[model samples]
Each structure stands twice: as C-alpha cells, then as structure tokens.
Target: AADRVYLLAHGKVEKVGEGPYGAETVLEVLADGAYFGDQALVDGDATWSYTARAATACTVLVLTRQDVLNLAERAGSLRGHLDALASIPEQRTNKYGEAAIELSAGHVGEAVVPHTFVDYELSPREYELSVAQTVLKVHSRVADLY
Candidate 1:
C-alpha cells in the first residue's frame, strides 16, 4: 500500500488534517511526483485521514494498494520502491553485508554483546545498561554523519 496522492507539476497542493471549517493543513512544497498521503496507503487503512487538493491545474496519478503490491514484484518499476520501503532494518545486511544477530536479552541466559567478556558477571542492570550504551554509541556515531 505505497500509493500516495502527490503534486505532479507547477501546482500547489493542500492537505487538511480535518474537514472544511476545521484547520487548513497545507501540504508542504513537495517535488514533482513526490509522495503525499503515503502513510494511509502504507498502513492499508481505509478512508484518507487527510484531504488533499491541487491549488493549480496539474496531472495527478492515483495508485492503489493492490497496484503497489503488484508492482513490487517487477524490477525497474514501482515494485522496487515498495520492496525498499517495506523492508525491515533487520532484513537488511550489516555493513559487512551479512545477516547478524544484533541484540539479545539476558533472560535467555545469553550474552548479546558483539564483544565477549571473560570473568564478567551478568547483573540485570549491567546487561541492560550495556546494550543501551552500545546502541546509543552506534546511533550517535551514525547520526553525526548527517
């Protein structure tokens, strides 16, 4: 369900979070063919939660959830977009391009850290803290790049 209503040309579009006489939520200036209302299609939910309109004349393409689902099967088409969009982070290979177990809970009596420790005691607090700290460090380092 990746289909979305989007502005396609030199036209202005608007989206309202609520009905008329309610708040006017203008769709931010989006590039031609860029997505709007993607969340509704992605979630496969019925009824658009927002109202969209083009302030100027422009061609608009409406894609259905079924259309996107079907497209994902074909290469060099919208299907690739769907596959990429729907893919989960875990399904993605690591930087080494490998499937790796990144986390584990000690309740399973397992040390989940990437590095193994000798002569280390597994206190509940320590285990949880270690995982959190590692995650924070990795995220911080990655975030810095952007």
Candidate 2:
C-alpha cells in the first residue's frame, strides 16, 4: 500500500498509471515541492493505485499519514487549518470521472479571482539533456550517471 506521501525535494519523478488494458500511462512528471500519494491519505484508501519511477536522480521527504495526524494533534491551530482545507473539494470531476477542475480558481457561492502570472523562478536549475546538480540533506557521493 502507498501509505506514505513523498514530497519531491530535488530532481524529478514520473508517476506511471495503469490503463484499463494494462498499458502504462505517463502521468504528469513531478518536480521539486510536488506532493504525491495524497489520494490515500485524503480518501482513506491505502491501496497503491499507480507506480512511481524516477525520471532522474531525486531526493524526497516521506511523510506517513500517522506523521501528519501526529502533527495535527500536536498543534491545535493546524487541526483547524486542516479541517478547513479538507472541506473544499479543490479537484472537481464530472459524472464521467474525468478531472474538470477549473483552471481559474472558484467554486459555487465563492468568489475567487483568476490569477495571471509572468515567468518566475528562484535560481531555476538548467538541464542540459536532463543533467543538473541536485541537493541532498546528507553529504555523500551521488552517481554521476545523469
């Protein structure tokens, strides 16, 4: 079961989904700060519904559901914040079960202004043929395969 969610701290990961005909579906490639395995934590299901393969060398922070619950328990303010966030179904789906979340954020009875943006990055890393330096919490030698 995929009970632990991983926060991508460095590099990239490709989430592979199993199609109805046993084909592999290339789900979105996750970058740094991307969170995965939330469906199990949010929906209370622990079954592994997909597979994750490293697209490149990566570093991740694993957080179990229990870890989250413990954090929420330790902080009363966090519990309230979590409750408010969980109440909003941010991702929407139609009867056909396809992701239909509006690109412009807003929901019925709620007023949300659409956000526009310009190119923004914090010292963005450059990849030449998928090769770049990555940071690790522990100092060690990493494979230079990339």
Candidate 3:
C-alpha cells in the first residue's frame, strides 16, 4: 500500500485500531488541521498500525514521502523538526517501539551482565511498483478478421 501523510483540512476523522477480541477501538478523533502519518515521512517502509476512517465528510491534504522530504530539504526548520521526530523511536524504545528491558535469566552469581543495544537495519528493503502500457494500432481489415 502507498502510505502518505494526511492533514485534516476539514471535517473530522476517527483513527481506529483493532482491540481485544477483534473489536474496533477508536484511537483518536481528529478535527480540522490535525496531521497523521508523520511517522511515514521518517520510515518509508513502515506500515500503519491503525486505520483512519471518516467521521464526517472531510477534506484532507495528502503528502507523499518524497513530497515531505523535498520540502524538508529547502526548509531548515522543517528538516530539524523531522529529524527530531525520527530520533524519538531510537532514543527510548526498541525496534518494535516497545520499552527496552534488560534481564538476565538463569545466570550464576558474580556473572557480569552482557551488554546489548538496539541495532537497526542500515539499509532496509524498499519496494516500488511500476506499470507499463503498450498502445496497439490495428488495421480495419485485421480487426474484422480477428
């Protein structure tokens, strides 16, 4: 799926996710001028964990990953803001965005705890889809014969 950032320009949107027993839970209700998918700008391959549904008739401003990056390149403040948002996941959480816990189980007394750190993929795989079409010109006689 093509993930793009959405800015709520008008109306309302309900951000929802699957809850226990497969129930639909409302994560948040966004009003006009709210933005979702900021994380998409940072991680191109990241999949959305939640879904956004229209609460009412809405108008949204959409920005693709490339669009946001291009804007960030020309705007120094925006580039800094995006960088700060990108670093948040690495600073306090594991790759899964969960709290990092250090535990040593089944260890003998006086054994030093092994050091570990979260390692991220330097070059993650990115997939892009493209389409090609051919236009064929058939003669009137050829078309009738077929």
Candidate number of the best lDDT: 3
Clashes of each: 2, 0, 0
The Cα local distance difference test for each model comes to 0.54, 0.72, 0.80
Q: Tell me each candidate's TM-score.
A: 0.41, 0.56, 0.58
Deviation from native of the Cα of residue 5 in model 1, angstroms: 4.4
lDDT of 3 by residue, 48-119 (tens): 888899999999999999988999999999999888877775556664455675755443454455676766
Which stretches of candidate 3 lie above 4 Å from their native place? 90-146
Candidate 2 per-residue C-alpha lDDT over 27-88 given as tens digits, one digit per residue, 9 for 90 to 100: 67998888798754554566875689999999999989778878889999877876775786
Candidate 1 Cα errors over 4 Å, as ranges: 1-7, 18-22, 76-84, 87-146
Please give, for residues 31-71, the per-residue lDDT of candidate 1 as tens digits. 46555756544466546655666667666667666665666
Of 1 and 2, the candidate ahead on TM-score is 2
lDDT of 2 at 18: 69
**Model 3 weakest lDDT span, ten residues long:** 103-112
Candidate number of the best TM-score: 3
Kindly provide the TM-score of model 2 when superposed on the true structure, using C-alpha atoms.
0.56
Model 3 Cα shift for residue 63 (angstroms): 0.9
The lDDT of model 3 is: 0.80
